[model samples]
Target: TKSQKIRAELLFKQFEDIKHVYYYSLELGKIFSTNYDKDVARAKLALWYNKIEEYGYDTFTTVANSIENHYERILNFFVNRSTNAAAEAFNAKIKAFRASFRGVVDMRFFLFRLAKVYA
Candidate 1:
């Protein structure tokens, strides 16, 4: 329940860009099947929404908007994750050379090499 509680807290704090909140209600044929308890789920969802609503924050509900997205979309979402990760790894290896004691290479020289790694 820690994760659920954390999620709930984040849900309230991060009421920004997330769209679409689904809450099911378990009722005797009011919304869903007579056997399924749809109203109960919906009640829980409403409770969550109410908690966040008190903060005067608002959001929208969105569904699957893309039909045939591809790997290029994933790259677009994280445009620089790959390059940045590589640069960080390379920087870690060269960090020792950055010490004032080492002074083996000029700071600008080291940075030039690092920049080339990313470029």
Candidate 2:
């Protein structure tokens, strides 16, 4: 395992793009994985944006632009580190339940059954 890691590091050093991309990914993971304050998170994200631009990779440029576009919404994560995961999961469950029943026929009954089971 140690040898494998050394070989991987050598390869990363040999490839400029790979090294940049790998470090960028690692930095982004560190940014989100830590429970940093909002200001600290924002500062890190700003640094990340600049770093991505400096990398000058087309794909990363596009991703950076997207982040810029949704900047506020993304930053809101630092407030509570919450996401719409629960809502999305519930929606998926509803879809699966409907599919299992071969689709909804009576809207009223469907609402009642959904409320009884999931409410």
TM-score for each of the candidates? 0.23, 0.82
Candidate 2 on 1-119: residue-level lDDT in tens? 99989988999889978878878988988999999988999999999999998878998899899989998898899999999999999999999888989989898999899999998
Which runs in model 2 stand beyond 4 Å of their true positions?
A: 101-103
Instruction: Give each prediction's root-mean-square deviation over alpha carbons.
Output: 14.8, 2.1
Q: Write the per-residue lDDT of candidate 1 for residues 1-119, one digit (tens) a residue.
A: 99987897688567643322322112212322222233443453345444445533333211111211332442332333233567787677667545634665466777786577546
Error in Å for residue 23 of model 2: 0.4
Tell me the whole-model lDDT of each prediction, alpha carbons only. Answer: 0.43, 0.91
- Reference-based lDDT, residue 75, model 1: 31
